[model samples]
Target: MNIVDRIWNSSLGKKYLMALTGGALFVFLIGHLVGNLQVFGPPELINGYAHFLKSKPLLLWGARLGLLACVALHIASAVTLAQLNAAARPQPYATPGAYGASKASQYMLPTGIVIASFIVYHLAHFTALLPGVNGVGDFSKLTTTLHGETVPDVYAMMVLGLQVKWVCAFYLVAQALLFMHLSHGLAAMFQSLGFRDHVWWPRIECFAKAASIALLIGYSIIPVAICLKLVGSDYVERKKYDLKAANPQPAPAFVAAQGKEAK
Candidate 1:
């Protein structure tokens, strides 16, 4: 068999693939979290950022497709690994506790499935601009003023979307599950990538836990802030700019008179 085929069939190769894809997705999460946090800033700041992304269709769609591919590969590899492990041990463990698996590790698969489902719902809720799905729809027509400049009303969309109590509750629950998944996945990714030295394992695990907690807080703040009205309840009035107010166009009679006088 060719080296590629051999690697494709090997457990180690699958682990490495999972680690690489998970790492990439983790980086994307950090970027996504940072962008989402812009909701706390002036409306135009986040709205302008959203507009900027939408303006670049090629780059935006390319990134979206790439992310989707990563998610598919990550999930597939995880499921494959789980099946392999299960098939290797057909009998149930007499004492499951003997493995000493962390709770996060034990629930990883279910949490991952939940997280994946949440991702799809999230896309439909926000990215797809679906109506009545968390009150998001036609964001292009929505506008808000910030620093005297009019921009897309992303802040309002976020606030409105999460204002529904059930939506917020669901979001919080999903985020908690995500935190659990990340807490375990991060350390496992490192170990799979061969960072398993006894000297640094403790430190790696500590970093993983800290990073997961930070991410959880960062993600949770959006819904929590909206719920507490920290981000405001009333929608900001859309700034309507009148063309005539900005620059008065000369009347037809005035233009005709001017032309007659010139003639």
Candidate 2:
């Protein structure tokens, strides 16, 4: 059989795919956190960063599509491997914990489902610039000028978007779930690839947990701070700008171009 067929047919191959995709996701989490933490900097800092990313549609969209593929493959491998395991052991263990699976490991699937849902909501809330209960006028129109170029004001959007109590609550819950999922998945990633050993197993597990906690803290900070008003523009003073975001009429030149294109 070809490698592709063998991989699709074998449980071992599925495990490897899960590990590879999970690892890639782990790295992405780290990078994403780093980019997000730029919010703590001046407006120009993060504004420039976001502008740079938008300017390079190829790089931005490439990474996005790549991550989307990784998420899909990771979930598929996990589900298929789970089915194979269930088929192998039709009889249930009378006692829970009869298997050496960690409590976190036991929850990988459900948390994964929740996280997937959160990903969709996240994309809507931020990527699509949807206005929500946070009372932001229109997230898409939030903008600033840098080097004579107009760019989306990401820093302000984050603060206002997260200011809502329920939004903050949801974000915190998601981060907690992410911590649980990653803590177990990281160790499992190593063990699946045959990196787990008697001497190193404890260390591997420890590292996994530490990394998970760090990520949880990293991700949790933004929403919490924004909700508490530690970041972003002042609401009372920024009412004028809020109006601009809420009612952005298309420029005549842009409309004319669109009309020509449509014709």
Candidate 3:
């Protein structure tokens, strides 16, 4: 067998793959949160940013495809390793001890599955612009002016989509699950990759918890802001002004008639 195939079939190789993919995803979450936080800025700022991304279709779709591949590899390796472990231990534990596994560790699989499912729904709601699912009507038609140019009103879409109480609630719940999954996954990833020295273990664990909490807070801000009415209705009104500013109407007919008579 080739070296690649041999490594992939080994237990250590599966753990390494999971660690690498999870680390990549963790970084992506941080970057994505920072970008989403721009919604708190002026309509132009976020809309312009969205326009910039759309202008680069190659980079955008490349990143999307890469992320999808990483997700598939991560999930496949996880499932394969899990099945292998289960098959190796066909008998139940006599003492019922969890073998020092934390609650977060024990529930990683289910939480990961929930987060995966949430990702699909999220893409459909925002990226795909699904009607009724995102609670926003004709999101593609929503436009805002940025530096005299009309662009997709991403800020308005975020506000309208999360303003629905149920959607906000669902996001909050999914974030909580994501936190639970990350809290364990981050530390476990390091250990799996052979960074489990006793001297640094506690520090790594602390960092994992801190990172997980940061992610939770960052992701929760949008929904919380919408729920408090801090972003929804007001943004919609602002968007109307932006659209008007981008495409000004002609002068009134009375003014035009007076000018014609004067000439």
Candidate 4:
């Protein structure tokens, strides 16, 4: 068998895959949090940032594709490892078990599945610029200027999307699940990599939990701020202007036909 197939078929290889992909995803979370935090800044800041990224189609898509692959592999490895452990673990002791393990660690698979579903909803809500789901003006029409160049107004999209109570609720739920998943996964990575020497393991776990909490707060604040009217107070006027500019009334069909006949 090929080396790739052999490695994939091995338990040790699956552990390594989980660890490495978890690490990649952890880094991505940090970067993503930083980007999301930019919403607290001026619209130009986040809008320009989004515009600059979109300007590089190749690099943008390359990173997205790579991240998608990592996500797939990480989920696959996690499920496979979970099944292996379950099948090998001959029906625990007769006494009460779990011994106070956190629910985050205990329910990794379910939480991961929910978080995965959230990712799709997130992509559609924000990245794909889908309308109706946002409960506001069409996201595709939400344009703003970046150095006089028109670009998708990410700032407006985020504010409007979160202003919807139900949408914000979903985001909060997703963030909670994401926090639990990250907390457990980070600690698991260290344990799987043989770092459970008892001396530094607790400290490592503490750091993981702290990191996850920080991410949770970072992501949670945006929706909360919008909901409170502290942010996006100008949403009404901004949406009207952007939608008008983006979707102006169509020219009269008879006038257009006459113009074409003249031509």
Candidate 5:
């Protein structure tokens, strides 16, 4: 057998690769979402943030290589595991309803594959992957740049795309599928990477589900809001600071409670 076939045939090697790459991608997703969240503020805000990320050419290249490695490992492990799983089963269903499936069971792999495709498309559309797409914005031309850098208005693309009936519908389906993928993937990855104790398993599962949903909702909001034009440039600019207040004044109830307790 070829070296490639021999390595994939080993159970331990496959699982180890999957666990490592999966963990890397999970952390990257969280970081990516945090960076992307800046887009909700203003074009300048996110633009500058994006610029900062790409400022050092070497660092950007390093990040790209790391991401490419993660993607390669993820897909390789997924395909290998899928084949192994099929081989283990080896029997076709005699009847369509012969086996019952839970929502997570039915959707995880399919949704994960779909989300992977979405990520590829997103990178192509927004990043400097394709030719003729300038990197970020024309920062030099700006009168008052936020951070002396510029990021493309990725939000505008999302808004315009989702504004179309068909595209919006597509994203809704993809987003739902993505949530299912995350629900399973996040839990599975943590356990695979040795977070497997009974005591922590349930709580980790809960945390995974909550974090996945929160990220999904946070991303979904920008598109929905933009499509509706409920959030414009002015609102984004104003909300930047408004959204970051850590300890604003207490509510009336809290103030009244303090007053009465003190009295």
Candidate 6:
């Protein structure tokens, strides 16, 4: 067989590429989620986390570049695989094929595509990189800081954004898709890397499901809390100082390292 055939035809080769690139993106998403969750604690906490990241310009940029690369690689491989799979089977099934599986298992690809669109819209709105503000999800707002920094209040934007029923609904749905994707993807990543065996498959799959559910719930709390008006922008101003005091270093290298090691 030719080199091109060898590269694409081999299951191990495809799985290897998917596993490594997917795992990298997964780790980044978990970290991003955790950082975003800081908005729940205090404005200062989230800003301080942002401040900490900004403090290391090089590392921050490096991470962004790395993430972009990983995402590009992951998306390219996924598209190629999907196309190949579609081409490999020309005849469409007469009816829906019966395969008993959980919701997470059944809709991985469709859900992932939806979530990917959500991510793009989300980044455009919140990150201020995208051209228009309509996609801002919910939190775009004008506000003043205690130190008199005139800035858009991200926490407020989140609160206000979620207050809109449609935005909240979209966010909740996207997160649900994320949860379902992770439910199976996590275990599949490990299995692809040869960490799986028949004895461990059941246990690993259970753990993945549980972890996915927990993360989904944790992230879902913010929108619900905001919708209820249980928490809002004032929470950040009240709690920023304490957060600033807690981790004055602003680099969080130790924390990031610990988290990676734990995983």
Number of the top-ranking candidate, with TM-score as the measure:
2
Clashing pairs in 4: none
| Full-model lDDT for every candidate | 0.79, 0.82, 0.83, 0.83, 0.63, 0.70
- Write candidate 6's Cα lDDT for 1-263 as tens digits: 99767866776777777778878877787798788788777666766566568669999999988987876766767778788878988998998764686777677679879988887777765665332343332222234363555444556556555666676788899988888889888888888889988999999889888888887987898778876777774554433443335444434355446434744
Error of 5 at 260 (Å): 70
Encode model 2's per-residue lDDT on 66-127: one tens digit a residue: 99999999888878877887798888877775477677888899899889888888888889
**Could you give me the TM-score of model 1 versus the true structure?**
0.83
**TM-score of each model, paired residue for residue:** 0.83, 0.87, 0.86, 0.86, 0.71, 0.76
Task: Arrange candidates, best lDDT first.
Answer: 3, 4, 2, 1, 6, 5
lDDT of 5 by residue, 58-118 (tens): 9889978998898898888888788787798777777674266557756666877887887
lDDT of 6: 0.70
Give the lowest summed-lDDT range of ten residues in model 4. Answer: 250-259
Model 5 error, position 194 (Å)? 2.9
After TM-score superposition, what is the CA distance of residue 198 in candidate 1 from its true location, in Å?
A: 1.8
Candidates 2 and 3 compared: the better one by TM-score is: 2
Which stretch of 10 consecutive residues in model 3 shows the poorest summed lDDT? 246-255
Residue 164 Cα positional deviation in candidate 4, in Å, after optimal superposition: 0.5
Report the CA-based lDDT of candidate 5 relative to the real structure. Answer: 0.63
At residue 161, candidate 4 shows an lDDT of 79
